[model samples]
Target: MKKIILTLFTAIAVLALAACSSTSGASKDKEITLGATAGPYTDMVNKAIKPSLEKKGYKVKVVEFSDYIQPNLALSKGDLDANLFQHKVYMENFAKEKNLKLSEVVVVPTAPMGLYSNKFKSIEEIKEGSTLAIPNDPVNLARTLIMLKDAGLITIKEDTNQLTASEKDIKDNPKNLNFKPLEAAQLPRAVQSADVAAVPGNFALAAKMDLLDALQLENMPDTYRNRVVVNTKDLESAFAKDIKEVVESKEFEEVIDKEFKGFGKPEWMKK
Candidate 1:
């Protein structure tokens, strides 16, 4: 029993030392790995952010993930130096839920959710009892609800926790809009059938729908805008600072205009 306990303690100590050593070696290198959800964001890092960093003497490698959770998990585990697929709300919530220390490096241009209709040509044309398709997931459902409220079609309850708000939190539906919650990817298709579909910005872009064509685009709050995220312990690191600087650069915004049109700029970028 004593020998088994001693051996387990020794193994644990060695693993801890290896983790620290790996982190120490990683922080000293000029090479950086940035994680993103596959598609536009991966392309954004490759086409826009990567070249700028390369010119400044850093080797920037981007890793693409198919899902939302892995990028942050990889970031927390130090497999990535930084990541760029999440909004501040997601980062804060994920960090709290997982008991991880993560912080935003900077907010970037985000595609805003848009209210679209195939039959009704305009917001004014939306009729009573028109069915609206919304994301079923809690956070995105909240976004859709908020956007609907902003469009003057609905009223969310006062003092409501809007981040997790659902159809039940709606105090009034002036248009008598019936919400059909669906997987986010299905929303673009919903516009063809449903009277109105509130599509989040990322999915709309994936479907190649023109954001400006929507009857209304979400006036996204700062918290909702996607941002660069890094581990909290690395907040003061040189590479982290460089990531913020690159996002703030004029070149980055120029790319946003040329390659990623219709994604709204963050407030910091607006200034």
Candidate 2:
């Protein structure tokens, strides 16, 4: 009876050890969830990032958001492991406002902003006093103004920092064009009603407006390129490192070239 009882206890101990070992393995392989907006950002992860990570035995989950605000919120709240939908300036401004500790993992390709007009086929055709729609947000409004300045439709004040310029900062409106500051998301629809609309690349892609159709486009500096961002704490983690590798890989460059044709320029090619 003593021998049989000792044998049963040993078997139970072995089973418990096995169960603990199995749980540990499962925890190590937990799927990582990344947040992004619905257009090219999501497409890049689903088409390129996912497969690349999966090949290395990691399962990646991509969560899509429509607006620009929520992905950062999600990442800050620990709902997402990382995100790839925002530019460096936008991310810095957002983190400062929200008091969130965040950092960039990599700078991916950029989707350059453009001036699109259905009413006028060319920038020269845009007449004086034409109501032009620009983004209401501070950073993007400034970006829009710079693009217009470059296109010679308007001139921004020489003293003002062009990156954050607002309608108040316009030094000259050559045609005396009317400026309508609307929500960035609404600019695509505004293109139909407004004589000229300045649209961000992502919003344009979401609205299916071809960049080639824009009368003028801005090939912005590297500071404006989209980034893969994570909570500052995770910047050195295995998952974050994998994400950086995947985004900077040749395969990802191909995705940018194929799916986003005229929209994104490869990071290496950035001036």
Candidate 3:
């Protein structure tokens, strides 16, 4: 009798432990967390992707970050299931520098960089000695210089490439324009203070600044050059597949076209 009682107790305890484990697993299986930048990215996720995903039986939680770095960091640390905030080159550079184990699951949208100004109507109007604000970050500063060169405002050193260029890279300063290197996020605000500012499209849109007045805008490819990044382990998740589908779908394509106002297009929808 004593042996039977002990066996029964052991069986009950094991069953209870299994039940708790099963419940925990089910809870985890029900939800997926995605991180994105605060502007168009988040708006698209909320307005289009989230509703589509939820209808398909996923509990989708979209997290928004203002800065460029946090979404990737969160995805790497397992705080987020995925992130949609950077381009291929930026992701590769960040992974190489940080030794992070992340992969692109799907491409969503592309936000091109544009040269904006409150004071000047066009590149032709930018006076000599006018102050031009550019992002101070290495990659973006190079990009801005390229745009300025494209505008025929100044020239970059013949040998310099897209990945490397500095104020020192300027070969000809015909405008004698003063180049002010500032944080990427701060460039929009500087438009009010500077004579001209080179701002990323997303930031400019977020600030409600019009790109029609931009002296120049980069002609980026129409599609998802930037992507949704995920942990290597979660790459095959069903929720991830659903998220990708929603982003790549025609419904989302319409959203991108209407919301971004030609600054970007859905990667999946672009030829």
Candidate 4:
């Protein structure tokens, strides 16, 4: 009887140990995984958001992608808990096309697209028949065209909007300027090949392009602010809550102002 009791106690101890190990593994798996583009957005996450979130007892892991497409693809496929890479307009268009159920958690920052040129110091300096490079992607191509229109460099048809604009949309080209649409990632480098290039803020910074005084930026409205996004199904998850707190925190805002200057400030910060 003594031998049997001893054996039973040993079995119970082993089971308890296994249970504790399983629980610990489960807890570690609860850490939130976030994705962002590989520039100022990733920098902001590391410098401001991650430390604040750690203080709040949440594990935050940031994954960086080289270009725009992979982050959303990962989030939709359940590989990431959230992404901080795109504006609402872009997200809406992506969601509709891909049939993904992702939702924006909060507006983080706005990297207003700027038209930069090594050949010209100002818009007035751009000559007739000047060749310009724009982003080839549909959404960004439209955005670049709009910026050009805003700068009075070109004119689009009156009915055109952000959702739809093509080379065909150009109504007036006084200079008969050449429109060369390239990928967003390629725009900065293409500046050397063209008279002017419309480049996104993050990529411009990555290329060490001095856009502050070198180019003209489009006037972005409050509606175009970029955001942190997550799967709609997981909107109420702990990970989403943690990401929201990190993005909307004062620390994050301070870092944006200090590191990025005024180039990437969200409308909320302007208030």
Candidate 5:
């Protein structure tokens, strides 16, 4: 009799454990956490994405990081369900270097990188040999050089891409421009001293710099569009699909227009 009682108790305990495990997994699936660097990314998620997800019966959490590294790391470590702050090229490079399984879930709008000035009012007004501050990092430096080329202040080699372009890649400098490379974070502050500073979109938005005041804005390529990134495994999941649909919806576009006036429409949306 005692043996029968023990067997029954063991069966009940096993069932209870399995039930608890199943419930935990189900709860996890119902909640989604997204990570992004503080600023535009956070603004988009909070002002737009969060409400969309919550309406679909998911509890959404937006985790804000102050720098580039932590968001990707957190997402990879399963601390975040997704992230929304990197270009595909940058994320691909980072994933390759870190051996992460990250992939782009959706392409968000291309925030046009712009040349902000404290001294010059227009690109033509920028005098010859004027020191222009650019992001020292390779990707942004290359992009800034391209924008300067388009502005006719300088010309980069046609063969150059953002990764390979440098001061030496300047095929011509009509303005006899003096280039100063500084940390991207410092470009906003540097504009006070430098004649013109090539600032990335997020940084400009964070600094509350007026986009209309920019001397020139880069025509963002499809490749430069910001993305919603996630674990490769999550790319096909229903939760991810819902999130993608929400961002690509008309409501989301309205938020984009209302929140980011000068930030141009995304190429994917052009379809």
Candidate 6:
């Protein structure tokens, strides 16, 4: 009888400890640290997402990264609960190359890349022999080149994978346009020198240029759209679910419409 009594007490203590452990994890999940690039993305989190999460009793902290690499590194190292600076292509590629487990929580409204020109008012106004500026990096170079194709400035080889296309893959160049590959950040300033500059949305906005002011904006794809990402291990966590719910909330869209005008939205947001 004494042995039975001792066993009962031990079981009760073990159950109590388990309850305490569960509560501690719940408490830890309530505090989330998210990383984003230092610009409109950071603003989006601060003004739109944070408030809704706060209402649900989550303490939100946003860390800004100037370059893209550090955010993912921090997230992989468990320094951040999630991050919001990269697209699907970048995230997947980075994860595979670095051997880190990461997943997207939700896709957000992303600013679209635009063709900006100081001289030309429209795509039709581009002249023969004009020196067009494009992104120097392969990924953006391909995307920017596609934007030019859509504008009727050039035609890419049908056999080519447009995702990795470059000037060498051009099947037709109606304008005899000279290609100048500049860094993405320098494209905004390239407008003053080059006939037209293909500037990514983030850099354009950071330079105080308006989105509607561009001659054309890319029909940004889901793969190219920015998303909220977290460690794959946390995919089933309550807080991760809450983050998705907060982003999907009507209030979040209201903030996006009011503050991030002219930005490209995901298809889910369209529906």
Clashes of 3: 1
In model 1, the Cα lDDT at residue 53 comes to 83
lDDT values for all models: 0.89, 0.86, 0.79, 0.81, 0.86, 0.92
| lDDT tens readout by residue for model 1, 1-271 | 9999999999999999999998777655779899999878898899778898888778788899999999999998889999989998788889999999999888888899999998888888999999999998998999888888888888999988867888789999988888898999899999999999999988898898999999999888888988888999999998889888888899998999999888888898777
Which candidate has the top score in lDDT? 6
* Over 4 Å off, model 2: 1-27
Ranking of predictions according to lDDT: 6, 1, 2, 5, 4, 3
Q: TM-score, each model?
A: 0.85, 0.82, 0.77, 0.78, 0.85, 0.87
Better of 5 and 6 by lDDT: 6
- lDDT (0-100) at residue 56 of candidate 3? 72
- lDDT tens digits, residue span 28-49, model 2: 7667998888878888779868
Worst 10 residues of 5 by lDDT: 155-164
Clashes of 2: 0
lDDT of 3 at 19: 100
Candidate 4 C-alpha lDDT tens digits along 108-193:
76667898888898899999999998888887777778888889988999998766678889899888898887888899898888
User: Against the true structure, candidate 6 has what lDDT?
Assistant: 0.92
Model 1 vs. true fold: TM = 0.85
